[model samples]
Each structure stands twice: as C-alpha cells, then as structure tokens.
Target chain A: MGCDIIVEEKHHVASRTKNKYTKNEYTGLPRKTGLALRFTGLWEGRCLRQFRGRRLAWAGLVAGVLLMAAGMARGEFIAVLYKASRICLECIGVG
Target chain B: MAEVGPGGMGRIRRTVQFAALLITNGYWPGLGRIAIYSGPAKGVCVPFLNCYSCPAALFACPLGSLQSMLAAARTLPLYVSGMMLAAGFAVGRLFCGWLCPYGLLQEALALPRARRVRLPRWIRAPKYVLLALVVLLPVVWVSAGAGVPFFCKFICPAGTLEGGLVLALGRPELRVNIGWLFAWKVAVLTLFLALMPFIYRVFCRTACPLGAFYGLFNQVSLWRIERDRSRCRGCGTCVEVCPVGVPVVEKPNHPECIRCLECVKACPYGALAFTMTEVGKQGSGGTPRISNFKVRNGR
Candidate 1:
C-alpha cells in the first residue's frame, strides 16, 4: 500500500519514464537481490543503500584516495592527471 | 559515479596551459619562441564572477578581476560581460551550484560532520548584501581612483584567505605589502577552519558571495531536491544531516539551498530525493514533516 501510494504520487515524473523494462520485467533481478548486490559493491545504488553505513563509505573513500595517490606519484599518465585537475578547476569557469 | 566525459569546456584551459609550457622556456627548456604570454581569456570575458584569483585559474573572474582589467584597458568590452550577468540574473547562484571550486571545497570539508548546523532565519540575507558590497560597490566606487581591488583587498575569503595567499606568503615583498584586509580575511578563514569540524560549510551559508549568487538558481535548477511527506515519518535525518541549515521539510526549494542532495541521501524511507519532479504530480506531498526538524522539549 505504501509503495502503491508512492507510485501514485509520482505519476508526474514516472510518466516521463520510457521504461525499456516493461513486459517480462520479472527476468530482471528482484528488488531485494538488486539492493543486496548494490550494498555488496557490485554496483552503485542510492547513497543510503550504497555501503550500508558510513564506515564502509570511509573505507571506500580512503582506499580510492590511496590508490590514486600511488598512481599519481609514479607519474602514471601525467597528462591524464593534468587534464583531470584542469577540468576540475575549469568546470567553475577558471582553472 | 557519473563519469564526466572529456571534450568539454575544460579542454581549453588544459590545452592552453600545456601549449604555454611547451612554448615557454620553463618546461621545454630552450624551445623555440621563448616569449610566452599567458593572460586571461579575452574572446569571452565573463563578469558574472568566480574566484579567478586561484593560481591555476585561466579565465578572468568578473567580480574579482574587473577593476584591474578596466583600469588597464580604460575602454571596456561592455557587452561581453553583459551575457554572463544576464545568466546570473535569470538563474542566480546557479553557477555556484554547478561550478565554484571553493564551494566544492566547503562541501568536501562538510562531509565528515556527524550532524549539520541549521542556520537561524536571520542569517540568510547578509550574503546578498555582501554580494552587493563586494561585486557592485567596487564597480561604482573604484572610479574614484582606489588603487586596491576593493573586494579582493577587503573581503574575498577566497583571494585573501585560500592557498593563493599561502603561496603568495612565500615572497617577502608580497608579505610586507599584505595589509589589514588580509588579516581580516585570515581571521574569517581561521574562523571557518575552526568551525568546519563542528558545523559544516558555515562560510558558504553566511559569507560566500558566489554562494549568494548561486542560491538564486535554487528554484529553477535542473538538479534539485524534493520531499515526499506521505512517506516521511518526520525522522529529521535530512535536517540533521544538512550542512547549510536548509529547512528541508519547510523549504525544500529555498533559494539558500546549494542542492547538495545530502538530505536526499539521509532520508531512509525514500521520503527525500534529488529529482526533476519525477513522481510528484497528482496530490503528491513534496514537503515532508522531517524537513521541519524541531527538537523535542522532552529531549
């Protein structure tokens, strides 16, 4: 009933959805299983469900930073690094 | 993880810098044609504004760099800057929402706080007045022959406070020339640095002119937050987590909101979201109770 209420309320934006997954949508994984996979880091989902908690998000963020640092110090594709920083600075109008 | 693609507006900055390094004597070390002059982008001058004083910044920021440019040229390209001002007037601080590295830095610092500090109703307007003083005042007053860039010299936490000032500090001549306004900027920075761990992005809420500009875009922004009161149990997680003190439940589309989507992330019942009005139609309660976020007297 709650989900149905939400679905009904969301008719405005949902109407815009050109759902490719219509008939035989059952072939797609169930909501629970998809959510579980997302929590397990097999795929990205909503932020609330992403890592189950802040600890894991911290863990992921730290690991990602360390990996980037290691790669950056070695001068691994300096052009790519330069380009990314440039883009980061430039996106706001100047870099 | 939206992997931002290449071949965007960014390529120009990188390409120019790279070409400059190659053509100049520094990087190439005795390459042909040593005289490499790298200045602000002239073709499309922007007056809308940003923290262009950043060392790596390529474009001239309208608010911060305007006096110097006009003083240098005397005859300004009045129409070019007009387009950017039009964009700002139409959309407001949309640039801060979409752009602004300093704003991004505040967001990053705000991330670790366990809870957010909601601003009192009284604090929101100071930023608008600041925008007028910093951006507008200089344009009007500088004609009287003020040598210093009024906004950059007096206020701008970005220019006087950030890494640019730190880098500039290394030169003794620059350090000696630093005045009271620089001290004020440092004091503001010191306060923000002190407050960031406790509250989040307080500067963005209270002081940042760029943020003030961007807040104007909140209602019309393509990416925005929406609340579903039907599902909300009024848990207050969204309010508790918001760094900018946005009253999510009461004013989801409030102009002050950066549209960071932190509230959307905090809503456990999927009551809040960053959306372009996906499902909110036919009797949909977009404002939720949790967004009001009041403390219980019992607690």
Candidate 2:
C-alpha cells in the first residue's frame, strides 16, 4: 500500500512539471506544436498588446505630475491665478 | 450587486453636473455687482469649460488658461497641459458626461423632444481643426499686453452667455464697449442653443476644442467601457441608447463616447460594464477580449 502511494505522488509531480513546460509563459495557451514552434514570439507580442494601454496611462500620469510640479515651481500658478481672477475682456467677448 | 439603470445613472450625472456648476461658481455675493471671485481657487483649472469672467466663477477654465499661457510667453503651457493630461489620461471625457455645465444644458435642451438625428461621423473633425488653428492662433500673433485669447474673443458661446451677458447686465458702464463682436458672439450662442434641442450636443460633437482634446485619451484612459461579447446578443440596444452615437458593440471605447454609461445600463443582457482598470484580461486593441476561462461553456 505504501509503495503504491509513493508511485501516485511521483505521477502527480510529473504531470505538474509537464504542464509548467507545455503552457506558454504569457498566454498560458499551448506553447509550441508541430509547425507552430515559432509561437513564443507571438505569445509575447500578445502579452505586450494586452497591457500596452495600461502601461502608457501610468507613464502619462507620472509625466503629467512631474511637469505640473515643475510648472508650479516656476510660478506658473501665480500667472494663472492673476489671469483667472481678473475679468478679461476677451473672456466676456469684448474686443 | 444591484446595478443602477440608465434612469438612475442619468439622475446621478445631472446631480454631479449641477453640483459641479454650483461649486465652481457659488460666490453669490458678487453675482450682480461685476465683482468676480478673485480667490485662491481661481489658480486651479477646472477640467470642463466654464467662463472665468462670470462673476461667480471660482476656478479657471482650462481652455482659457491654455490660450492665455500660450499667447503670453509662447512657451509650452506646461501647467495647463499637465493638468489636462492628468485629467484626460485618468478618465477621458467623463467630465463631458458627468460634470460639464454646458453638457448638462445641452441635455436639458435635448429633453424638449425635437427632431433628434444621429450626427454624421465627419462632424467630429471640426473640433480638432479648431484646436489646431484657432486655439493655437494666438501664440503666433502675440500683442503687447496680455496676448489675445482668440477662441474666447471670437467663438465661445459660454463666454458670451455666462461672462458677457452677465457682466453687461450688471454693469451698464461695460456695455458701451460691446460692439459687433458681442453681437456676433450672441448670434453664435443663439445658433448653438437653438440647435441643441434638435441635434443633441451640437457644440460638443462639432466645436468644443476641450472635448476634442480630452477625446484623444479615450483609447487609453484608465476608466473605460467593456462589452462582454460572451453575453452580448448584438441586439443594437447599446448603439440605440448611446447619446453620443458610439457603436458600442463594434467600438465600445470610441472617442465620442463621453462615458455616459447609458449603453451599459440599457444593455438588456447585462453585457456592457464600466471598468476602472484595463490591465489584466482586457484587450488593448479596439475590440475587447474575454479570456477563454471566462467564456462559460465555450459559448
């Protein structure tokens, strides 16, 4: 009975290892089979495409914050404050 | 979770829009005195277009600030650009749907049950042109003092209605300065107001440079609409319900979609949804994808 239990454990380990290697690292689709052996590149491309928008958004948000900080440091806020506070003739469609 | 219907969502939106209007222009003390709010809040730019010259406006308009910054020093308007980028990247034109006072007014106009027609797709191009040529025109022809804010001076109906009319009514002294330009602006404002009932967001779809600017980020905005193709029957309900005419099933995150969420609520199959994150399991391509695991029974 003990010997049979050991054998079952070994089979389970083998199957897990097989799955780890057979699945694509990114997409988890079946990796390469027959002529489709070049699918590694395709899987990587798909992975990148999936997350591109999210990555770009984060990068843009960071860039915006930094730029805004720089502008504030340069007293652009003061300029905006002065301009916004005053009633401009242009804003009122005058002249 | 109990999902809110289009009616509930619309009421929430109107409430938010009204609250935003009041919060931004709540200073009633100087409402009829020609004395505008000159507080520290005026430094911060509001995402949607609100005329700063209005007596009660407590914050700056981004478009106005952008033009002013550009026309004055001709340097990159880093501050305004940064603010716009942050807002756009975060939520795209969500401001247009839920916050813009003008959008609210347009919706109110649209509610009167006029001849509503789906605007041609080509109508989306003019705002971009206005942004490129008119908004940026002041940068080149900079005058001596504060440079000319071209869009405000010549085009903006909000400036005419909120700022010009209010100030003119309040202060008789300022009305003397009003001439052909004011008349021209009034005509333009009247045209837009008249068209709003029939066409639905006529100014926004065709001429709002601010909307045009924010629309660019719709593809990559953090907040987005996703359609579950697994359940979507392609019944055209979403398309039928969309106020901005976004072909929801075909292109869910179309630039014109203002994220009004009417499509999501109106979809009988509960296929469309608003998602905050677009990272995992979502498609960056125009058509959103569902994972194989998520597609029940290979349907």
lDDT of 1 by residue, B1-299 (tens): 11111213123323443443222213221112221113423222332334343334444455544444333233332332343334443334444544554544454455454133556777777878886665445445544464234555555666544333533444444455455545666776677766665555566677766567657755544334555555555666666665566677777767777654555555555555554332233434545443244444222
Q: Pick the candidate with the highest TM-score.
A: 2
Model 2 score (lDDT): 0.77
Error of 2 at B245 (Å): 1.0
TM-score of each: 0.55, 0.80
Q: Where is model 1 more than 4 Å wrong at Cα? A: A1-95, B1-50, B66-99, B107-114, B143-148, B162-164, B228-235, B269-271, B277-279, B284-288, B291-299
What tens-digit string does per-residue lDDT give for candidate 1 at A1-95? 99998888798456434332331232221222121221222223334443232333234334434544553354422322232222121111111
Model 1: clashing residue pairs? A10-B279, A13-B278, A95-B56, A95-B57, B93-B213, B93-B214, B249-B291
Angstrom error at residue B271, model 1: 4.4
DockQ of 1: 0.03
Error in Å for residue B51 of model 1: 3.7
Considering only chain B, report the TM-score of each candidate against the true chain B. Answer: 0.66, 0.89
**Model 2: per-residue lDDT, tens digit, B1-299?**
11233434676667788999899888888795779899899999999999888898989999888888888888887888898998988778889988888887888777433313678888899899988965568777666765678888888898888898999888888888989999999999999999887777889999999999889988887667756555565666677667777878788888887887777766655556665433224333344333332364354
The true-versus-predicted C-alpha distance at residue A47 of model 2, in Å, is 17
